[model samples]
Target: MKLYQRLHPGVNLGPTDPENHEEAEEKIFGFWIFLMSDLVLFSVLFATYAAMSIQGVALGPSPKDIFDLSPVFLETMVLLASSFTFGLAILELKYRKNQGRLALWLTLTGLLGALFVGLELNDYRILLTEHGAAPQTSGFLSAYYLLTGTHALHVSVAIIWLIVLAVQLATLGPVGPVKLRLMRLALFWHMLDIIWIGIFTFVYLYGVVL
Candidate 1:
């Protein structure tokens, strides 16, 4: 048996080192499979949004009126930075063997995510009160609510997850279940950042520019 194999207390039905290169490769492939399924779900939502957008509301503000690229730009930057921080957290956990630093970085990740959501909510409030562009006001509003709200819901969930993991890291430290959970969380955070990039590009930027 390999040294890692001998050291692992759990049954070697699979991998011991969760981030072991070979195991990580297999896991990433599996995650991509699951992500494909998720993509299908998002595709359906996009199609729905597209269909609804065609039935445009006559009186309400369109994307041109409601969206400001500047806030979105900042939100995107925060998430992108958080993704990089998560990568650093993982690298630290794997290479440097630093638990306090790992948790600190993860906490920062959570804060960044919270900041993004806060900005989103703030934007929505401003749009609704200041501009009278609530979701009920337009078909464009409907689609905007559906798409951005979906992503916001996702962000909320991720934040909750980060909080839970923060607790876990505090009590359990970075091994076994904690380690696996953190690794999965890292993947999730990265995925959110990438998805936000698409949202900003396709939904916000293109929506604005075009």
Candidate 2:
């Protein structure tokens, strides 16, 4: 089969034909293992937040007092939209092979990611200033900052990666290595999206509702 025919979103493009490129398969598998390790790290962070948040308010503001659902909702929408745009970029590269179109989609993805980070920082500022809540204020606040700040750090890295990838795509024009790197980056980006969903549900929605 042709390369484009075999390529699909979220599908591994690394040498499936074991006889020809066994090394490529190994690399892809190793990258997956790395992602799994990251999952564990995020899982731990989530558990810590859940545990520490219950009674760690410690005379400080509660989640309901500090978390504004409006900005949280907006941040969630922005990140989700970035993920969608990234999927579009992948489709463009896999099907259309239009470098310009792919660049446009990737740029949109980066912009949305930046917006999410900006909103998150603004939220943090509000928590610190308006509510007098900082990481040092209480255990709950510390956990909250650690969890959300870690996720924000990942988002920041992703935005930087997107910029670098865009430059590579512009210069190299989606060659084999470029395509493989893009696929790996896509996996990482999608993983962040999934992690954010956990954060939104467990941290934001739960905080507001419960």
Candidate 3:
């Protein structure tokens, strides 16, 4: 049991026995598996978007016509900043063990994420109202909405998760389960940032250039 525990320092042995340690490992591993499944789902969405985007504009405005780079740039900056803030919160929790600092950083991250979502929705609304770029109007618009809307949905869920995590940190401090949950959330936020980069480069930048 000691050997197993030594091999896996992340598993909290606390007052519980080896069984609890095994359970903790299982939980973390299970979460990773779930993340893998999510990756597959996102991959499918990306592929579909790519396939459909070739015919995206249809009779509506082309990507270069209605796709404004300014708001997309802002949204990208805010989300990337949120990811950095989340890293700071992780640092505070892991090293400083300061619940107050962690909570503040996390709150900032959540606010930034919320700002990104708001900007995205506003951008979509502008496309619909000012540009008449509704999803039903063209194949390109449909793919555009699906791809970006899916990402926006993930960001929304992450914001809610951040709120719940902040409450947990306040109530429980940096306990084992809380730390694990925070780690998972960090992974999620970072993944979203990476995915957004792909979107920015492939979907937006390429759309504009070609």
lDDT (C-alpha, whole model) for all candidates: 0.74, 0.82, 0.82
Over 1-210, each residue of candidate 2 has an lDDT whose tens digit, in order, gives 754234342453433322323333455667789999999999899988998889788888888777778888888889999999999998887667788889899999999999999999999888878888989998898999999999999999988988888898888777766766777788899899999999999998999888
Best-fitting candidate, scored by TM-score: 2
Clashes of 3: 1
Order the numbered candidates by TM-score, best leading. Answer: 2, 3, 1
Candidate 2 lDDT score at position 38: 93
Using TM-score as the measure, name the better of candidate 1 and candidate 3.
3
> How many angstroms is residue 15 displaced in model 1 relative to the true structure, after the best TM-score fit?
12
Clashes of each: 0, 0, 1
Error of 1 at 176 (Å): 2.2
